[model samples]
Target: MWMLVNANGYTLAPDGGNFSALVMDGGQIVAVGATDDVRLQYGARVDRVYDAQGATVLPGFVDSHLHLAWLGMQMNMLDLARATSAEDVLAQVRQRASTLPSGAWVLGANWDENRIANRRMPSIAQLDRAAGGRPVMLRRVCGHVVFGNRYAYEQAGLGIHPANPSDGHFGRTPSGDIDGYAYEGATTLLERGIPAMSGSELERSIAAAIDSALASGITGVHSEDVRHVGSLYRTMDIYHRLQAQGKRLRVHQLVGFDALEEYGEWLVEQANKQPTIEELDWLETGAVKLFADGSLGGRTAFLQHPYHDAPTTRGTAIYTQEELNHRVAQVRKFGLPVAIHAIGDGALEIVLDAIASVPAVAQRDRVIHAEVASEPLIRRMAALCDRMIVDVQPRFAASDLPWVEGRLGLQRMPYVCAWKSMLNAGLYLCGGSDAPVEPIQPLLGIHAAITRRLPGTSGDGRFMNEGLTPYEAVKLFTHGPSYAIHREDRKGTIQSGWMADLTIVDTDISNSQQLEMIPRTCVLQTIVGGEIVYDRLR
Candidate 1:
């Protein structure tokens, strides 16, 4: 029983038209038309009126992949994402350590070595000097690698040369000594020592992250937080509690692969109870999240060919083909889809093979971050697109495009971050931020999707042909998500009978030139399910 007027609305429907007004009742859109006509028709019954002030209104943005608790934790952790040199990182670590007690751990995240002046991770000795005996662990921007000081290793209950994980390794000196650098599975060695957040802390962190997301115009997120909270039960409990407390952020919770057994047990409990209608709308179980490989920036994404920049390595694979197949089968037994993180073509190939081997799981799988792929891989992926979803982080192009060509070579450049190609080949793509790794703003993702370049940069972007049109780019966060989650009939558009989830912004993004303004656009209001969850004016 509310109305929004003065909006430059992009219905994103068939024939693609604009409307100025919309009506909602009982959390569903009831009507949409010219502002005067709708206002005249519904004026008597409407209990509230929202003035958009001629701003643009589109479908609510949904982040297809992210870690909720971890993103919230990053809000309080040391931010090294902007550091430009090794010295800058060391200086920040020193400053953070100075504020903490002598033996307390100083944890930080999101430091990219490629952006540093030296183009290298700082040594353990350098970290030790900066930390001044305090335990310190700094995660690389990719989150697959971590560099720690001596005190950190000791505090983590590890010796100078702890056993390397079966799935990953520890960086070693020329003479074979541990170098305080852990990659892939080895990162758990350091993480196990970092104290776990209590239930209240986790709830606060999730709330803070949701506030940030809603402010950025995101109405929904498919979050993976089981590992961050240290227990699947705790993570699900917090989300359920938050929903009952009237939090508007819609969360599609993805259980981690390690917690598959727990998820199965939880499913039995769910079967015995009837969830309320509000609970169904606010929170729902998603697929089991699995990592097939690491990240491109960390040189750990399993590639078909060795890296051009670093010829000695072809990147690390978290699981062999046989193992991945086994895990997918296990998830199938629980009757849940699998969302596997596979960035490079090598990992994608293995994942495709695994899916192809399991006939029952073929179209039900989700490939997260297919950042690098060849023609054959795309074709293979398209074959399963009947129900399969490819979850992509559009913002990654803005950050990774500058150096991805160097990691991969000119020959592979055409296939890297090729979104348009995938779309043209009939693949269903859903956009995300991978926040704490990238910013959570959906507009930033839209900007990157259209420009294929950094926000302020000019000229043709790298692989400009691979870029999507403004409307197509916007769809990645809008209709794309609804399609991915099988809610197209009720969400993703502003038509009557659809769910009333709308993102109102300051920019009218209808064409290519207007895309430049997206990076600077401010979200005026975020309305989810007929409720104004975030309003800048208020």
Candidate 2:
């Protein structure tokens, strides 16, 4: 039994109220009220009393989207996320290749051409020169495109005139020669040649990612790791083993579409049994994650019209509408909802139409990254509020606002990352970092939601009318996530019988000044199930 007192707290309960103290026992919030009242009832039996010193306390923040295994591996890769120019990226590659053994593959990630000085991708020759005879492959920030040197293609069994794969194409110069860039499915061709990590190495990376998330005050995450871990059983077994070490992050594991066969076998193995409350508290199966299209940054988001900047193409769709419909039906047989990634209007329309065709798939269906939309599409989605949830990355507005208007036209400005409009239309929104694509800090996401401006900038925030209030923005990581995972009754609040997951910050977020400085707000403690997982004070 433990008690937390002298705190400014928001319960976020059904009735909507506040509390000054919380009493927790056996991983549940047993009592919450005034400090005097709570102390009078449970102070005698409490084993410890934590003083918050009047800091703000709220439900633990949860990331509704992210790739755990990928983020872990990216942490160790050559980080080019902050490279300023094409030359800067090549310089880093050159530095990385110098330390590697001869012929070793030099890997890097997160290079954004939009942010670079020349606003261009490094050429194959530049990469070849930088790598100094070693093979090299670097992923764009969006993860939809990759740049490689000639050595990499040759090592992957592709000759100079290698044909494009059926699912995707390699970038070609005006003369129809390979340009060392791979789109979507073409990335698999190069990836197959890279060495796989051993089980111990993979587990270490997963553990590091989880600990990093916990340090950021993220007590839980909806993570997709089956594909990265290589199998459904391995993904589950890894999480189960991690939980045994006390104070682990809660994970809602999503199975990838590629693992459906293994998922079916695993489902049948446990068809007759029921999961215990403890089993759900640590880890549970989420929905099937399927990519409907690529990313906006790569101009492969399957837009309804050609991109304003690139008038030649409307972008690519990984699956045609008919294919997506069939896949959804296949997933329905397992009795689980589907979380579809639809970033552009074209992809969103196809996803919506597919769901409308099958009402069963609509129930608890999640539309991930519904980034581009028109008024009509918003209205159509509003009608399905009872059966759907839109998982959005709030920081996207902060990161994409500068170039979004150019990619989409000025006419499409109002519809770009219209989060406030979505909320007003009665749509349920869950927030996420989409880490490695964006930073995994919830406060940065909240700040982005409220400001809608790039960090360290001055002037009216872009699309100011579409910004959320402090409280509403906070809910994106709190109440909204609990509802998305179907654990609203047990996790989203600090009420009696609710899980004892609390995040303590040094500032009261209700204050506009404090909220505006959210990115600088210090997290004093992060507690999950009544156990302190992170303590800066300690």
Candidate 3:
């Protein structure tokens, strides 16, 4: 049966003119043109007609980078994101401690040292007092560092003495005692005590993440939580069952590089077992993700110069160039794409070199969080053209802008978040919210790209000169990401023979002034593969 969808405004194709109506049959767009033309073609045989009621319909958002399972787990954990001071963090910890078992591990995330009143890392004594000797680990907002209580340190069998702190350091006092601040490798000490989620719990979390994305107008995402690999298989099974009963959401999974050794053989075997396309348009494996360095927030982003705040120290590198090159070569040999986490200038250079080493045929090599790329590297990236994809988070400008200027200094600030440069260089730009790091809402990201200002700030907007137009921002979240994952032929734009994945909003977002109000605009509906998975009106 055919479905005719008529709207007041819509972008029918990336380069084509807007249209008033579209027709879908068998989960694929059959035609996109005038309402009269669509109605005349399928008016009599149409199973249903959807009126957009003047909303602006466009391609559904594609979040190319995110950890869906972890975001779900965050919903149940103690949220320290709102804690404004060290005292506030301790108070929340103490309040939650009273209800838990005496020896239970207290794990929480989303705390920033810059936001805390003290402007300093939390101490072991402070966490110990709050938790009453229970093992506790609170991750910084960046997820690259952790603050642990004395009990956690003891449980992990770590001593006060720093063990080759260069790799990652444990915060210590003048007298050589653990101060609870764990940077880099030191964070692993607390990971041992955190309990793993059951299969059912994992499925629930994945469902919650999907629902959350739908509400935010995110129809699809490329997930990177390898820790939940088992959970992914379980979630896929559950999704298959749900679809059999007629329900499911679209998802694309990417395995992390760390698990490549343990699961590489399995993925190679399962690649042949992939279900037919008709059975599932909602999930697929697109790439292998690798981390080249840590995060900017932790000052471990692997840079050429020392951190502005910590002049004595440059950032840390998670993997050597030789190791990364070997891994990329191995993964490329399997015909799978590779996406590397690279935030700093030095890290980006290394990843780019590794890509250069790969054969030209092995394309779609992505650099996630290409936040601080240099001009030379941008030129090198341009040479790859469509082969190189950049997965960037625009929302970071609002949260990290305050500290970014100080980190890179005024001279280098202009080069940061170089979206315009990438576009000018002819490279594909894929926008994403590394959710749990930033909120998963695409509009927030759109707002960031167009505004380039921190929340509640009135100053000449930070990097206002570098901001992108609303149309470009929307394209980044839509066609750009689809091209990144090599799915532009099937997803991305609303054209004939393409998957009917789309989002409808109340306002015209192409205008810059209109973008400021995007967050308030309602997502009237989200359709995936011709199925009305999320409809606000209903």
Off by over 4 Å in 1: 276-278, 361-363
lDDT of 3: 0.78
Whole-model lDDT per candidate? 0.87, 0.87, 0.78
Clashing pairs in 1: none
Candidate 3 residue 341 Cα shift, in angstroms, is 0.5
Which parts of model 3 are misplaced by more than 4 Å? Answer: 2-6, 162-167, 228-247, 361-363, 455-460
* Global Cα lDDT for candidate 1: 0.87
Return the TM-score for each candidate structure.
Answer: 0.97, 0.98, 0.94
RMSD (Å) per prediction: 1.4, 1.4, 2.2
Q: Give the alpha carbon lDDT tens digit for every residue of 87-124 in model 1.
A: 89989999998999888888999998888986976788
Worst 10 residues of 2 by lDDT: 354-363
Which digits, one per residue and each the tens of the lDDT, describe model 3 over residues 1-538? 5554557555536577688888887888888888888888878988888877667888888888888887988887788988888888888889889889998878788998788786764567878889987988888888888888878877777756647454577777888787778877667655665666776787677678778888888888888766553444554565555455444567777887656664566666566887777544576666788778788888888886788778887788776888889989988777777888888888888888898888745448788988887789899988877577888899887788778887878877877898887788887888999998899988888888878875445555577767888878898788878888677888888888898888888877776666557766778788877777788888
